[model samples]
Target: MKNCPNCNAEIEDNFELCWNCNYSLTEQKIIDIKDLNENKKEIDCLRCHVLMLYSGEYKFHEGPKIGVLGNIFEAFVNRESFDLYMCPKCGKVEFFAPLQNSEYKFE
Candidate 1:
């Protein structure tokens, strides 16, 4: 196991980049991306009770500045991308992670 220099989070050896802070272990620098969130799941919207549409992905580029809520997501999602869902009825959006040990790809 290794620790990320930016966040000091424990990281497995298999991963090249630090999932917690997007730190590249080899490059020793932060990587850049348009959006960190990668849409990879499909589900029903809770409020509208309708199937949510699979939206595109997003990356933080810069971490959220909203304080606790933002920090929570930063920790949960780490630096890995996440999937997004939008309600067709109410336009509500949701985020989720890709399944473990699965070959699911974004369509």
Candidate 2:
């Protein structure tokens, strides 16, 4: 295990990024997460009432099935992806659809 220099959190050796704090072990600094676009909306955590930081994109993958019918059904299912955001203070996570594909607009 290794300790994150930024947050002093214990992390696994294989992981390059610290989960508690967005510190990059390889870069030896805190990562600066960029906005998705120029008009990207700032999300605040409901519990902490603090700004949430964009973690990364996550995608759902099809898992192995037990039968042929299950495999067929899985083929027709659309895998969903979302942008992950986490509250820095409370560590609460929230998922949002990609900004470009979302129908809801933020003012």
Candidate 3:
């Protein structure tokens, strides 16, 4: 196990990025993922009532087959990506749809 330089969080040896603070060990710095939209909405933590920090973009990938209803389920719930936000104090995480391109078409 290794320690993250930024947040001092314990990290696995094989992992290059710090999960707690999003610090890149290889790059030796924190990864700042910014939103492309100029008028980005600031999210507040429901529990803490403090402004949430933008973590990064998270993408969902299809996993193994889920029996006969896998295709049908994927068709109905076809979300691909989302913007992740985290509360600095309470470690609360929230997911929001991409602000730049709100429309998503499954193809």
Candidate 4:
């Protein structure tokens, strides 16, 4: 097991990046689109109860700002908070959270 420099979380040796804090020891960043897409899950809207489609496409300093809550600076880099779920029918959206080992649930 390797320790992540950003969050200090224990990462699998096979994983190229840190899943907890997006830490990278390598210079070339290889984003696993399939793994990332599977990160978002769908659920009923809190207010409207409408079905939403969670989006996971965003860019840092251009899209949403992540880990900006409080004085928390757990990561070395600022990443874009990808909108995980959205209800186009109701126009509701929710940001993605750190998820580990949870299989993507699509409804």
Candidate 5:
């Protein structure tokens, strides 16, 4: 905690404004993950005509996973990052994009 310049009150480092005094904190950036998620565009499947699912984020691993006895596993694991909306009828998967690009989007 640091002393507020205006009132000399102790303020947490993570906070933008001091609790005791309305002191402006500089050199801090506030990122809103919810706003970014809400603004992301959506895409739909053309064949299924239903909204696709948002598969999670994926990363490539260089080495294979070894079992207890040193058994090598070839296949990689699927990592889900974001929310996915899959088609109930066809089970098509899609990522968030733009409404114009997607076949299904809320008007």
Candidate 6:
């Protein structure tokens, strides 16, 4: 276990970001795709018919505050970061959870 530098929360060593405070251990505020893996295939937007650009990883600081019902739903889908992608032609965005200990597959 490791302590988060920002929130001082105990976190597993395998985690790169903190679950409590959403703090990233890496110095870069936004992770660069080039630094990850060059061989990762690009995603094409369905509407635009053009390659989508990797934006960055996104983490929520807190569960969204949309009132009582939103709070209940937040518990089910909380403390997760997603890979963000944007289509230049249509300005459409998409997100996916990063795979762990596995190869990225496009379908």
Predicted model with the maximum TM-score: 2
Q: Tens digits of per-residue lDDT for model 2 on 3-70? A: 88988998778677676776888888876545422255588889977667776779886666657688
Per-residue lDDT tens digits for candidate 5, residues 2-69, read: 77776777776765544443454662333232332454444455775543333444334455467663
Stretches of candidate 1 off by over 4 Å are: 1-40, 61-78, 100-107
Candidate 1 structure quality by residue, lDDT tens digits, 1-107: 78889989887776656655667787898754223323444466799665555655554444564765875666655355556666644557787655552665545
* Tens-digit lDDT track of model 4 for 1-107: 88777667787776556655444557445334344446466577787665455465554543333466533443455554345665433455676643542453344
lDDT tens digits, residue span 14-102, model 6: 66655455456876243443444355448878896666667677876554667768766776764767788765445678988776424
Name the runs in model 5 displaced over 4 angstroms.
1-37, 55-62, 69-85, 95-107
lDDT, candidate 1, residue 96? Answer: 69
Give the Cα RMSD of candidate 4.
16.9
For candidate 3, the per-residue lDDT at 47 reads 95
How many residue pairs in model 1 have overlapping backbones?
A: 9
How does each model score on lDDT? 0.61, 0.72, 0.70, 0.54, 0.47, 0.64
* Residue clash pairs of candidate 2: none
Model 4: residues with Cα > 4 Å off, grouped in runs:
1-39, 62-77, 98-107
TM-score of each: 0.37, 0.51, 0.47, 0.35, 0.29, 0.44
lDDT of 5 at 36: 29
Shift in Å, residue 38, candidate 2: 7.3
Which stretches of model 2 miss by more than 4 angstroms? 1-26, 32-39, 61-64, 67-73, 102-107
Winning model by lDDT: 2
